[model samples]
Target: MDHDHDFEWRPGETLEVDGEAARTEASWFREVLGRYASGVTVVTTMTGTASGESPIGMTCQSFTSVSLDPPLVAFLPTRQSRAYAAIRRSGTFCVNLLAADQADVSDRMAGPSDDKFAGLAWHPAPGTGAPILDGVVGYVDCTVEAIHEAGDHVIVVGRVVDLATGEDTKPLVYHRGDYTTTG
Candidate 1:
């Protein structure tokens, strides 16, 4: 309820509600958070069709490891995310960590295209039916554990069921609206 300590208000830009500053512009929040560099990932899930199953995926940067002992991971997806909606129905998903060379994949997945898996080579994850993209730095296959509503995004907690890593691949990083590779 009290979010006064959650944000740093700009000078002369505070909104007071009963002597507490209200929420600020979403763009301002995004701009401030974009300064930090983050690794990129393609979160994928499978959706059943009239004939068979199909892959649905989206480029996501709001992903992180939550625990090692329990093998937990988390990603934030916007409420309007169609891929996430399919993932929720599937009850399983995979997070494919992108290599530096996979920026094209990231761009394609991040777009509004209906078929993000077009022209991409992928296989089903062993533990989950979610698509595991080729040429990624690593993959984390998981089952949906919990979901928490946070503003316009939903924080999805996943219990990792399987994982794998690729060799000699540089991670793709996003910083200040641009993509870069680590040294």
Candidate 2:
């Protein structure tokens, strides 16, 4: 086994390290990473609510397609996220790709609110019972396939079970800590 302790690991940048502390290096690392643009998505799941079942969602930009043969996808959520916990319990989730006009929805879901789904319209995904937002560009229903611990986040690999595509629309993009629409 080769242990590479001298390598400096950053989220989206590579740097050679002499003696810089991780905390001090993280700010610059994060700023550099922000230069990379990424599409915004809301990862949602149905959870037990007082009346019946309600949707819990959180905005995430770390989603990606992992495999095509086995139909795998993945997203990273912070360990402290409540929505991630609900998704884990349900064993299923839906990835809602936001349209450029859906920034309000993304903001609402990303915040720490008891009723994130309040005033939002959504329906259950046919296969997984996950909540799929109405105005998203598309949605992917998935079952939890695997989970790996990564620092303060968990990488959740999901097996895509069902999906739906909506009309062509500008995708919501995040770059440099702000939201924008792609050309």
Task: Give the number of colliding residue pairs in candidate 1.
Answer: 0
Clashes (candidate 2)? 0
Model 2 segments more than 4 A misplaced: 1-23, 49-51
Per-residue alpha-carbon lDDT of candidate 1 for residues 1-183, written as tens digits (9 for 90 to 100): 554433422211222222243444644665788798899999999998897888999888989999998999999887768888998999999999999999899889877787888889999999997999999999999999999999657999999999999647799998877899989
lDDT of 2 by residue, 1-35 (tens): 33223442222122334354654576577689889
| Model 2 lDDT, full chain set | 0.84
Off by over 4 Å in 1: 1-24
CA lDDT of each candidate? 0.83, 0.84
Which pairs in model 2 have colliding backbones?
none
**Candidate closest to the true structure, highest TM-score:** 2
